[model samples]
Target: MTADPRRSRSARHAQPSAQRAAPAPRKEPITVGRIADAALEVVATEGYDALTIRRVAAVLGTGPSSLYAHIVNKDDIDDLLIGRLYAAIVLPEPDPAAWREQVTGVYTQIRDLYLEYPGVSRAALAMVPTNLETLRVGEGILAILLAGGVEPRTAGWARDALSLYVSAYALEQSLVRQRRRNQDQEWVLGDEELLDRFTALPAERFPQTRRHAAELISGTGHDRFAFALGLLLDNLRPASG
Candidate 1:
């Protein structure tokens, strides 16, 4: 009995083509979480200026297109960076009796988170909340204000004001650290020396500056932050009867 050759040929051809076997896509198996972490690393090591899709992709051993599969763009990455930092902030429950302290505590935690990641704060300047974590932080803040008897408009404004103040403060702190890190190792001046120079300025013309030099440069970052925060909190008054 003869086997049918055409049937055998058709069966062979019908089998899936190995030649057409597309090489499994070179996906780097990255997750949104991993990409977000890599973004933070880039900000921490190189500052926010170096945080780009290309840079993050390189850090992740993948291409920018692969990152797009998980993140949308630079703005999206900014949101993630801010979100990552905010995720560490544990906002306190609103206490009407202690709302001022609670609000301060919440922002203090936020500032610390920013400092932890260094340049991540730079990405937060003027950035609207787009991620869940960031929004959660905002909600916590607003709740504190509302509990404090702040009107809706006042609560909203206070929320924005606090966020701006904290982010701006963090951004300035990061920039100073970055500058110091970039300065010449041999030519560095201590903070006291820097203040002394200010005081040493021509006393004839810069009298106030010379007299108040110590006061002007007084306090650590935390001290100045607490002072400024106090000013804001102490002045927030509810509507008078």
Candidate 2:
């Protein structure tokens, strides 16, 4: 044993090698899903207008060119963002008796989601509902309308109308919130202040506006949303046979 100095030295080196920990696993490669997640994070933190392909890529620690391999362009990212948000909605089975309630619930879900990521609804305005998830929502609403005996054409048109209303409502709310955040914007006033301003207009020429100032600022916290939704849904009568 004493004569084998080279073998002893090799054994000491091998012992440290065997005891050393293995290298850490590599980070997961970027995918479409990961890209979508990063985009949402950007929108959530910085608002939707701040979301760009380059920003998303920076969030994912990659270059914009790499994202192009997974997504087409900024419009493509908008589609993905809206599609991902729509995917979270839980569609209900059509019930003729409860169609109105079900439709209201779905629209409420969409409104809440849009509010969660301010300005995200702007992406929905120009979208054509081509994404599978977006189409799924449209299909769900159509089923409910048809179940309630609405004519096919009416149901289709009503779906579009309701979608437009929700998107516009969300976008308006987002814009108001943004304005409120900037205190320097005089137009961003409380309902009472707005009513006062309306009432302060010249009397003779602005009689109607002054008289109806309270009514003009009447609704609060989606009361207008509910009223408009009811107006749209309540008028949908089944065609006479």
Candidate 3:
């Protein structure tokens, strides 16, 4: 299928050295937006650590010097990737009856967007939201929270709470998936192999843990996230008279 003319995914993932060859020759100059978009694509495919000035230029059909004329380095691409991430979120028009639904919808969209560009989630780890687009999102989110009856001071905290919630969780998921992928490939542990360690533990020393081991290991992450959200929303409830 042809790449979307409007939004490009190539930036989300850099071409793997094995899969990559020379980028197709472009007749003219490429804009910063185009470079940023491509960087997002490279991150999505190759991951954050894999992102580099060389790789981004490789995707753009240019060299490092050409890319540097636009982006100073890989960190610049990371900053740009976060900007693209901010673009994906859809904020609600703060309304009373619709506040809950609106906030819920916005959160769900954000969670799903992080899932799309897994690597971009790391950009939130130590990154600041200095970009204008990112600031606009914060403004919109704060408006939604304040309209939902949260106090102005409380609503301020909610902005950080919700934003961090999604990014932190997404980053954890990326780490978990990467770990599991490596484990599956290197040792190829069988189901029984993982179970054997637990089974071998001293029953007398850790009876309670053994009893609930299956529950602890097999519970879904989605259920945990929903539970956390449920608790947050409950805490954010307006005080009673």
Which stretches of model 3 miss by more than 4 angstroms?
1-26, 183-204, 237-241
- The alpha-carbon RMSD values of the candidates against the true structure, listed in the order shown, are 7.3, 4.1, 14.4
- Tens digit of lDDT per residue, candidate 2, span 1-241? 3569898788877756447788998867888888888989999999988999999999998789989888877888888888899899999999999999999999999999999999999888867666788888889999999999999999999999999999999999999999988979987789888888999999999999999999888878599999999999999998678
Instruction: Return the TM-score for each candidate structure.
Output: 0.81, 0.87, 0.73
Best by lDDT: 2
Q: In candidate 3, what are the lDDT values of residues 1-241, reduced to their tens digit?
A: 8889545667556566677577887666877887887787788788877778888888888788887777766666777777777787777789976666676677677777777766567776567666677777778877877777888777787767877887888778777677778855655444566566566689999887677666655646777766666667667865344
Candidate 1 lDDT over 84-193, as tens digits, reads: 87888898888889999999899889888888877677677777778899899889988888888888888898788877898889888977776778756544566688
- C-alpha lDDT score of every prediction, in listed order: 0.84, 0.90, 0.73
Considering TM-score, which of the candidate structures 1 and 2 is the better prediction for this target?
Answer: 2
lDDT of residue 103 for candidate 2: 95
Q: Where is the poorest 10-residue window by lDDT in model 2?
A: 11-20
Go through the candidates in order and give the clash count of each. Answer: 0, 0, 13
